[model samples]
Target: MLQSDVPIRVHANWRPLDPGVLGSAGPATYSRNFAGAPLTNTWYPIALANRIAGSDLAPNSVDINCNFSSVFNNWYFGTDGNPPVNQYDLMSVVLHELGHGLGFTGTMTVNNNGVGSWGGGTAFPVAYDRFGVNGSGQQLVSTSLFPNPSIALGQQLTSGTLFFNGTAARIANGGASPRIYAPSPFDPGSSFAHLDEATFPKGNPNSLMTPQIGTNEAIHSPGAIGMGVLQDLGWTFTTAMMADDSDGEKVGCCGTGKSAMMQDLKMPDAEQARLVDAAVELTKASVDQDDPKFYEQLSQSLMQLKQARSESIPVEPVNDAEESRRVFQPMRLRTTTPETERISVADDPVWRDNFIKWLSLPRRDRLRIWGGAPVLAGEFEHCVAVGGGGRFCCTGTLVAPRVVITAAHCFHLGCIGSRGEVYFGLNSNNPGTGRVVACKCVPHPDYKLSTDEHDIAVLILDQPVTDVAPCPIATPSQIDDAFFLRLAGFGLTETGRSGRKMQVEVVVASNNCSSSSHQSTFGCKRDREIVAGGNGLDSCNGDSGGPAYVDVGGRFLLAGATSRAAANSQRGCGDGGIYVRIDKELEWIESVVAAEGLSIACDSEDESEEQSNSGSVKKE
Candidate 1:
């Protein structure tokens, strides 16, 4: 047995054997001191040993028995007399006998006439008896119906067909139940206690515990069925102990085959246990209706475990490339940006005045845009209204079915206290169209009111929004040199209350651009912040946390979140505003999504390459 922290006492003794029985190995005797007591410790059914039945002082033979209550230790091999060879491996025999001492043998005692009795009829059935069933599916202990219960049970043990009813054993056997040894003409110590020799012939991988051992054959480890039977007998084991040969062939004691088996069995059972525990936890916390992927992941882990045991192989480490491919990738959406010659607002003073007037108006009077019309139906469907009831405190963008990205400051009133309900498609006045309550809100840990460096938070919806698809996020490389962008939101506009969603065009401004107060503001950090809107169109008070989109290969990708209006601009919504760059926080976003088990697909280069190839083919 493997070394354990628990201490146990074992005693070994040897006596001279009769030469006539030299071919036979001795039995492993055990006594249950605390009969009927619960097995709470590693050691139980303490073992005791008697003299060897083989030739006296034979170097090729070993006569050692261990306490099943204690771990097997101190294996000593004999060097005198007929020394060990490929035919007889002293260590292999010792381990096999030790397995017998550890509850592998049946508790039934038989007489010359094949009559049997168990524990002097004082104790309940042992662990081995629990799985024994006759051909008629009747339990072995129910032999009271016979006039001579012992004789009837003995006859059954010698000739009747018996099956093991352990669930794990059945599963391991490919749904075919496992059978026990029961040959004609009752044989003591070998009949009821072993697997039938006829069923598991010599060279059969599962013949470890059979009644007879073949000459010149060394069986090193218990096969898969053997391990499963032990499990049925309440013997706990690790995945390594349960490992088998890849080809399902028995391994001999002397070659590299035995060494390889031992090596494969070295995987710590604790690691497998941890995996099982994780699977259980995921199962308990999973919402089957909300995420079917949870079940998929759990199934994958289970399959790994099954593969580990069936093939006697260790769990393979996950490949980074494979893992990257498995992660969710966001889908890019088609944009409606017009390709016609555009009008520049650089010299348009009248439009600038109109934008200022729109911002200066009352909240009830200001529209989402100065001269802009309602957003083309279903254009910015990923945009959501953030707040409770028919009122919205801010705007947000959905990057995942259950995840919404918004400003950290929006939760100033405490995310829970704000009691917000995210509206996925709020183009109309109907609140019932796409409303979902926020289940959780997570803000960037480094976010601060003073610096606003990490002004981002993600809201988890109570239920996934399936009607509208999420918007694809932009990478730093895709948005760094962007000269123009489209801002969309349900914030205040010239039309008042920003009742309907609206979009406007904005131009990227210089980094040094400051507000009217002459304070160096709108400082654009390549990774953290972006400055935009030198044009007449700009975000107003209610537009904070809304999306700033850039055209990437004719698709609209979310580049940033509306952060703040230009402090130096004559009107807060007129000149330029600062937005939190999404590319800067991609790592944090990915981490949070993974930790929460929220699925969000990211754009993949492989998909882009495939599209490129298809387009080239079309062009040809």
Candidate 2:
């Protein structure tokens, strides 16, 4: 178990102990520092990245130096020239310790997760016997190891397999599941394997409970090795979640008596033989308890018991609504066509004054700090409408070039021809009076309407209006609740009153919506009700497709869209109209534009210039 504050110790005598050539890793020699002292208050691995320098006497073993220093609080090894011990040996030792700490003891095999028969198994064994063999002495690999096999706890012995990656290996000793790792492949002739524990987190590829290779030259954790030794000794360690007063180290419940588990086992040959006997008994007991036939029989018995325990099928009581409703037929629409044709825009009274007012300069001074138009280079001005519904909504300004950028959602609600014609540069009262530039609406595909998230849209007009050019669009930014917002839309001026009218209000409202659970600020559940009833400042039905602007550092940010009307709302919308939170869906918005071959909102170009200039517009 890992301690929060205590330092684990490594002995001073540590040195490089690899038997094989550096193999894939080159022969790198490092200067030694701590040679005579035992490392204290620090953890060390059984195998390390450090190298052992050979002395004149012995070519096999090398000495490590542990320089006592108050700076580090104890002796430690590093490959850097300053460290005393041979860095390579220290790395190996640490690796060994990590294994024991992660729990790799007993007869469990990591490959198939089967118990290995023991002639004599050490804490970190050199080989495996878990693979059952045929009568002719041929090795029969366990069936569980195959991927997508019928049996659970499959075995995998191949090296470089992601199942035994190093990162996943480190997740032992109570770590989260599905750990990703890159495993080190085993060298040729190495027969070690890993063990998997049934209790380990699901989808975790490497588990010490599973068997793994034991290379004397490989890097392994010494602490893990020590822990395994203790387990083999018949002592179990229980980690403590609470703090401990003594030593301040995390407390753990372990054996306390003199005659602890495996206390009688001797070392050398006698110890090996005793361990083998214990392994056989354990394996026999496990096999007897969990034979495959026993499980199949148990499952069948349980099924039968469930069937026998079922109660008599009950009859549903008769309900008047069910009988009456079942026989009820829906009313059909009658075909009575005798209506006068509606007047078109061409026949309507021409209102140039209203158009001039709509095209008047927006209240830039009252805009949100992070929102509104910024100055652009050259002569053209741009106009941007931020709040729009669905995916084709967003804000942009017309620079010298006639361009209008409202959100993609504004145009996304209905398909082209099916949707209402877009009218821009109109005054707050008469939005349709502005110079009508028949629009080409384009919406991003990734935009989803489920949560009203990622609502961005763009519009292209037939020509640009030179008199009232679009304002330059600001860059996207993150805005918190502290940001103030403003809104402008041709939505209903009041709740529940939907009509062909536009309302522009520079109200200082909170940037964040009230409650996200409802999908919109106005969406109330059956059990819950919003308290804002009398406030006249609520979003209404007509506000469904408008921009909510946030002020960030003098920039006008398109923060949200009016999305949902209050639940149980009358035909005419009422208080607590909801708006789509815009900041949360920026990435999706950008992706839609990039993937659609459309230029960014801030790009300097306008295809609508010709249409915008066609109608002669006088400045307000």
**Which of the numbered candidates is closest to the native, going by highest lDDT?**
1
Query: For this target, which candidate reaches the highest TM-score against the unseen true structure?
Result: 1
**Scored by CA lDDT, what does every candidate get?**
0.49, 0.28
lDDT value for model 1: 0.49
Worst 10 residues of 2 by lDDT: 257-266
Runs in model 1 deviating more than 4 A are: 1-370, 413-419, 513-526, 605-620
TM-scores for all candidates: the values are 0.37, 0.27
What is the Cα root-mean-square deviation between model 2 and the actual structure? Answer: 30.6
**CA error at residue 150 for candidate 2, angstroms:** 93
In candidate 2, how many Å is residue 370 off? 24
Q: How high is the lDDT of residue 179 in model 2?
A: 18
Q: What is the number of backbone collisions in each predicted candidate, taken in the order shown?
A: 21, 154
